[model samples]
Target: MSFANCGLPYHIGGDIKDRSKLLLQTPESFLARFNVDVRVMNEVVSINRADKTVTIKNLIDGSKYTESYDFLLLSPGAAPFIPAIAGIDNPLTHSLRNIPDMDRIIQTIQTNKPKHATVVGGGFIGLEMMEHSTNLV
Candidate 1:
């Protein structure tokens, strides 16, 4: 139901020496702990409040299906906001919103080995990125 250790990339490097420590819960652990079906890599495309149903698409094969529910809780998190700046779309610039984004940022830092990195926001996520980036230096 959730990416358990989203905050992990901030603590671990690209090599990921100890995956067990980083992984907060596995599918088996989650099932045993909460007795809930965990669906991973599925995207909720639409919700029908009238019928109390949600339409979800399998991210792997692009196949979609619908499921009825008595109640639905939507928790679509926010994406990193990139301002309309020149060269913001450049390959060198990166933002950390998900695990992939964090991986790419780490890869860029390791490969390029930049002396300085500029984090735009002073928010929690921004501060985390700044801290991780500082560790690389």
Candidate 2:
């Protein structure tokens, strides 16, 4: 999902009402605009520099294919850090990183309707989640 990651909290806080606004571009739109084939659910398992080919796995079908490319760019983003604390694996504990995470948080908030929330990290995402969560509660 190519979206404005920074605006996740605002969206959850009801500041950004339209969820479509958070999406920067769709794969089809990106391909149409830039003529670049953006594969979303494909994972590059391995790269062969000698052959200039990459072995990609289809996440949906579990099928593997090799594609040759002139240039390969890697931009694996960060993962939410879960501290090694007791009850850290609880379902209520959420980390805001991607759209799915944000959705889960919203669903949890709506379903559980907890009165209080404990935000862990003090980073941009964390602070935004805290602010939005407060507004939500």
Candidate 3:
């Protein structure tokens, strides 16, 4: 999960040659290598402790399903801690999350050519983003 944060910062810095390299295992490989089911583009919406089932929504389509598991590992990974602000949803603000956020920030930097950028957060990812953006300068 920590490596996920590591992935985006490097992409932001243009350190990683290819975006696919960030993945340790492809969805198919993860399923094949381990006897685990890898469901790509599935959004886990809720977990029912009483029923011992996890509700998942397919991100691609609007289909929803449930999975019953004897044991479950909640490893969604840490998301960029974006605090709620009045205008935070405005077009300009962006936080480095998954590939899309990294891509959007990079495109914004290249297209807009902003002189100064402010990255808020004192966490590891924030520090990494600072180091990455400095190289871009």
Candidate 4:
């Protein structure tokens, strides 16, 4: 279930050459291998412990339905800590968190071809971003 390869951009030299190599498993493969139901683009809205049911909402369509579950495990992934800074929302500024974030960063780097990139944080992700930016330059 781990889709976020946070360090992938750095490993692949900013541009992902082959996406199939990064894909750990497809939904069909996951289902066949683990025998677990996989529902994408769905959000868990609420859980009713009294009735042992949970409400799930479809992200694409504004539809909600309830399903009974004997046990539930929640894994809310971490998001990038975007500080409130000037021009942080600008199209030139970018942050890498997931695959899409990395893609956007790569696209911006290729399209804009900036002379320099200023990474805010000094954490692992930030360092990776710095490395990628340097390589791009």
Question: Which candidate tops TM-score?
Answer: 2
Clashing pairs in 3: none
In each prediction, how many residue pairs overlap at the backbone (N, C-alpha, C within less than 3 A)? 0, 0, 0, 0
lDDT of 1 by residue, 19-97 (tens): 4445466677899999877788889999999998999999999999998999788777787788999889988898766
Candidate 2 wrong stretches, greater than 4 Å:
none
In order, candidate lDDTs are 0.73, 0.88, 0.80, 0.76
Using Cα atoms with residue i matched to residue i, what is each candidate's TM-score against the true structure? 0.81, 0.92, 0.77, 0.87
Please provide, for model 2 over 52-98, each residue's C-alpha lDDT reduced to its tens digit, 9 standing for 90 to 100: 99999999999999999899888887788788999989999888888
**lDDT over C-alpha atoms for residue 55 of model 2:** 99
Worst 10 residues of 2 by lDDT: 125-134
Model 3: per-residue Cα lDDT over 43-92, one tens digit each: 98999999899999998997999999899888766865668878888777
Off by over 4 Å in 1: 1-9, 12-20
Candidate 4 lDDT tens digits, 8-120: 66543646566555657667888999997888888899999999999999999979999998988888778878999887889888766677776777678778878987879
What is residue 57's positional error in candidate 3, in angstroms? 3.0
**2 or 4, greater by lDDT:** 2
Error of 4 at 111 (Å): 1.1
Provide the clash count, candidate 4.
Answer: 0
Positional deviation of 98 in candidate 3, in angstroms? 1.0
